[model samples]
Target chain A: MRTIKLTLNGTSVSREIEDNRLLVEFLREDMKLTGTKESCGVGVCGACTVLLDGTPISACLALAVHADGRAVTTIEGIADGDRLHPLQESFLRHGGFQCGICTPGQILAAKALLDANPHPTRAEIQHWMMGNLCRCTGYYKIIESIAAAAGAE
Target chain B: MVPFTYLEPASLDEALALLAEHGEDAKLIAGGTGLVNLMKQRLVRPDFVIGLRAIRALAGISEKDGLRIGALATIQSLEVSELVRRHAPLLAEACGHVATVRVRSMATLGGAMAHGDPNLDTPPALIAMDGQIVARTRRGERTIPVDRFFTGYFGTVLERDEIVTELLIPKQPAGSGTAFLKFLPATQDDYATVSVATRIALGADGTIREARVALGAAAMVPVRARMVEAALSGKASDEKTLGDAAPLVVDAIDPIADFRGSAEYKREMAVVHVRRALVEAAAKAKEAR
Candidate 1:
């Protein structure tokens, strides 16, 4: 087992675990932070996206041990107490989801994109969101939700 | 996925020791795009995963006289980098065409090259740029020029207990232009069927001095067409010359058949991409001159 300490959601947490555990498993099974989903388990489906030191990455592909000394952000961390993040609110208002399994990943992916390029063109948004696939919504509403949020800011 | 013992080495030396101790049973996990997919397929059941994400050696992009891209630099980072866009535009070009935004965010430069998947886009482009692979183990570090790095189908000269640390691309001598083009991912879970990378060096008189033409998914490893290179050498930069040389480009290739296309079809498309890439490269070279 290895010990890892890192800031998650602005709180520093330390834990000891086997080295081979996947970061997604550690977050969901150990920490009970279930906001991050695991869809493909192979890094293709973006359902496992998390911000590792401010960049979005598929946590499923990263070992829990690698998260040592690195910062991580999940969907649970996106909200301000009871108040939802603007991106989350936009996702809700714009019907950015259907079954909701892929929403967390989609929302985070959008956040990363918008944070970097606050006012992405429609085509830029589409290209950036290419990795995060949402099967139920066909991505029309998701793009609109992002465009609306970008416009809001 | 099969059960495995995992270790996240605090330093490169620690990682190399772990790799040396485990040998073939140990595999480095980065970005997880390639290995995790293999795990899902039960194709690889590594008993030990030597995680390098924490090691400082395998991250970030810095430049000197030439571009120095850390092997662990995620494709996403590479695509968004101002340095990459300015120094090695073709790198950004090749990376942008990879799977999608989400995958790029974590897929490392090292993992992609070490995996040596022929269908993957970066190898051919790097090969054309005369890229070099930097690898390290507990013993020491060494470099392999891109052309000498790949051995065969899904094979690389990277030794056990070694991890690729960086991919160094030398500055293009002034008066050179590079272009990379690829067909979309038409097959399920496969690399691009045909991808082409062309680098053209023009003389002051606007004649072609030297050219590099490489194709991926057209051979066991990404192949450099000697015949094509010879045809372009010392030739005037013109449409007819590149067009005439396109067919002979495949003389050096021996493609394998898969669901993407028949071997014959892949070779024919290789000709098309090579021709297209050459024409584009020639035009860009002329513009640069």
Candidate 2:
């Protein structure tokens, strides 16, 4: 076990976790922030996407200890008290999801993209969001949602 | 993942000491993008995982005499670094094509090189550009030429106590051009079926003075095609010369039949891509002239 002190969402968190505890598990179980899902246990599926120091990374592949002293932002932290983030609103407005297992990851990944490149082209959005797979919506709605959010922002 | 003891060392000296004491039973993790996956799959189960994230010394990208990229420097940093883009654009381009933006954010150059995965994009580019990997142990430091670094699939010459410190990429000489071409028939994030990296240096008369060729996913390791290099050297930098040298890589490569491509198909693609990479590099050399 190790004591990891990190900033999650907005709060500073310090916890003792097993050495092998994955970041996804730490967020879901320890912190009870279940918005970040883990579909592909490996890094490919991007369902475990979270921002580490403002850059997106696979929570499943990253150990909890690796997040020590780092800032992590997940879907749970995307909205204000009553308002949704621009991407979240856009996702809903654009009907960007169906069955919604991949929504949290998709929105968080898009958040990272927009944060870095404010007005990315459709191609840029596609390229950046390629890792975040959406099996239900067939991708067009998600792409449109991200593009809409870019314009709205 | 199986339970293990995670050790974080605040300094390089401490990390080295920990490695020296427990490296045999431990696995040094930088980004954890590679090693963590292996551990989760039960492919690798080490009792101790030495976390190098806290060691501030092992991170950054700078251009001094040449490109000195710290081992812990993320691949995303290299892709966006102006120093890397200006000096070794081939490397920058190769780094950009690695898995995904998220993976690049966490995967370190040292981890990729030390992972010794032949299917990776950076090795061929690094080999073509004459990059050397800097490794350190309690004994001291030593530089391993990128071409000779990989011993086999997922293998390197690095000792148990040794950890890769940084990668040194020599600046390209004047009148030289480099190109890294990855043939990804599947998806952009998928590994290349047969990728090629070529460097062509033009002589005063526009003849090839020196040429280097390396391929990824072509063999157990990144295969450096010396035969193709030899054939292209002293020859006219033209399509005919590229065509003649192209077949030489088939003899050099030992591709396996995988979902990406059949062995015979990859062999053929290797020739095509190698020729195209050489031609593109030669054109750049002429343009530089």
Candidate 3:
């Protein structure tokens, strides 16, 4: 076991994790940041996506130990105490999700995209979200939400 | 995916030392995009994972001696860099077509190179530029040509305890041009069907002075289409020369059957991609000149 020091959301959080602990487990279980979802416990599906050092990475694939001292932001981190992220607002307005299973990942992926590319073209938006699969097949709606958010930006 | 002791070494030296101690029982974790997926499928069962995240030196991109790409330079970084686009447009263009934006942000150059997936888009493109991979270990440091990086499918010449530290892509001549084309499998995203990277330099007389053709996903290692190059030499390359060169490349390669493509289909696509890449790259070279 190793004690890791890192920042989560807007807080400085530290903990000791098992040598084999995956970041997805630490986030969803230990930290109780259940907002971040996990479908494929592999990197293929971006359901476990989180911004690690400002990049959307799969929490399931990242070893908890590897995240030591790194800044991690889960879906739970996006909004302020009582506010919603702009992308979240656009998602709600557009009904960006169907079953909501891929919502957290979709939102987080969009947030990362908009963070790097404040105004992305429609093709760029589709190209960026290619890794995160939506089994719900609400891709057009999701793409619309992200595009609408970009237009607003 | 299984339980394993994870170590995040703060320095390259520390990481190499840990790897030296653990040897084959240990695996190096970079972005963990591909490695973790394979591990989850029980394809990789290492007892230890040496995470390279903390090694600051392995994580950024900058120019030195032509172009020095840090081992951990993310695909997103390459795709987003104006320097990469200017210095090596083929690299930027090829990386831009990687899985997706989020994946590109998480996937590192060295990790992808070290992962040694035959279908990977960047390696063949990089190899076409005659790139060199620099690796370091507790034992010592060694350099491997990008063309010789892979030994087999999902396998590399990387020895235990060694970590790739840098990639050196020679900056092209002022007027040279390059292009890459990839055929994604219709069934899955995990593999590549046929991919080609071609670079051509035109002479003052406007014929092919130099040519490099690299093909991936059609062989165990990225194949350099020597016969295609020979066929293209000093020719008035129009669509015809490119068309003729493609089949020469097709004959030169020995593709294998995989879930992504049948050997026959792969060989055919290899021809198609080579034709397209050659035509595109040759035109670009002529325009640049």
Q: Largest TM-score belongs to which candidate?
A: 2
Separate DockQ for every predicted complex = 0.51, 0.84, 0.59
User: Cα RMSD for candidate 2?
Assistant: 1.1
lDDT of 3: 0.84
Model 3 misplaced regions, further than 4 Å: B185-190
Chain A vs. true chain A, TM-score per model, equals 0.97, 0.98, 0.96
Residues A57-110, candidate 2, lDDT per residue (tens digit)? Answer: 999999998888889999989899899999999999999999888898899899
Across A6-74, the per-residue lDDT of candidate 3 in tens digits comes to: 889968988998877788999989999898888977677788888888888888877787677789998
Preferred candidate (TM-score higher): 2 or 3 = 2
**What TM-score does prediction 2 earn?**
0.98
Model 1 spans with C-alpha error above 4 angstroms? B137-140, B185-190
Candidate 1's residue-wise lDDT over A1-153, tens digit each? 778898888899999987667889999998999989998787777898898887888888777776788899999998999999999999889998899998999888888888889999999998877778778879899999999999998
Candidate 1, residues B151-186, lDDT tens digits: the string is: 888789999878899999998867888899886656
Lowest lDDT sum, 10 consecutive residues, model 2 chain B, at: B53-62
Tell me the RMSD of model 3 versus the true structure: 2.0
| Ordering by DockQ | 2, 3, 1
